[model samples]
Target: MSDNSQSAAALVQRYYDAFNAGDVPGMLACLSEDVAHDVNQGGRRTGKALFGEFCAHMERCYREQLTDIVVMPSADGRRAAAEFTVNGTYLSDDDGLPPATGQTYCLPAGTFFDIADGKITRVTTHYNLQDWIAQVTGTGA
Candidate 1:
């Protein structure tokens, strides 16, 4: 692995560390000003301001804990993939649309990050929505 690859992996690690520490500001620091984040289970959040909103919403809805984080080089050194499990506790009533049962849930997710100029420029995240619904509602197929 080259130095760039190692650095990229390190950056991904930092992201997970920030998340586990609940340091939203620190996580944002690892991103570029024009960062594009697609929180698959959530929605697309672009730019720093919108990203901050998304983070705030997440903090309001769930207490997040990153259980396992594994970072690896992707197609090139500039890109990396991180697989992680995020366990969350429902904090308040779900008021967005269909009300939630207000139950705790564990979500296993993966993220692919593209780094540029030592910052994360883009991130594509994946997770099972049905599993999340099941964990929250205690009902599913």
Candidate 2:
């Protein structure tokens, strides 16, 4: 990989590190002011304020950590992708998901990022919602 690509990978790695540490401010620091977030199986939200709101809501509903992370950056350093495992516990009821009862779950998830000027401009996350629902509901294999 090129130097720029390595830098992109480092930026993504730092983002995940901040996420694992539950450092919302650190995570936001890696993002551009006008960051765009594409939530898993959900609509897109733009800007740091909205992103912070989303993070707040997530904090209220769940406690999570990412592990087994692997980041891959594009050659030009403009894009990157990461795969990781999410270990989490449902803490409270979310808007449309199942009710929470402190149920713990492990799920594989991935994210794509768009980077520019050393800041993440866009973040898109993906995971299997149905699988998560089943696991939390005691109905999955």
- List clash counts for every candidate, in order: 0, 0
lDDT of each candidate versus the true structure: 0.83, 0.96
Q: After superposition, how far is residue 15 of candidate 1 from its true place, in Å?
A: 1.0
Residue 1 of model 2 has an lDDT of 85
Worst lDDT window (10 residues) for model 1? 93-102
User: Which stretches of candidate 2 lie above 4 Å from their native place?
Assistant: none
> In lDDT terms, how accurate is model 2?
0.96
Q: For residues 1-141, what per-residue lDDT tens digits would candidate 2 score against the true structure?
A: 899999999999999999999899999999999999999999999999999999999999999999999999999999999999999999999988899999999999999999999999999999999999999999985
The 10-residue segment with the lowest total lDDT in model 2 = 132-141
Model number with the top TM-score? 2
Q: What's every prediction's RMSD, in angstroms?
A: 1.9, 0.7
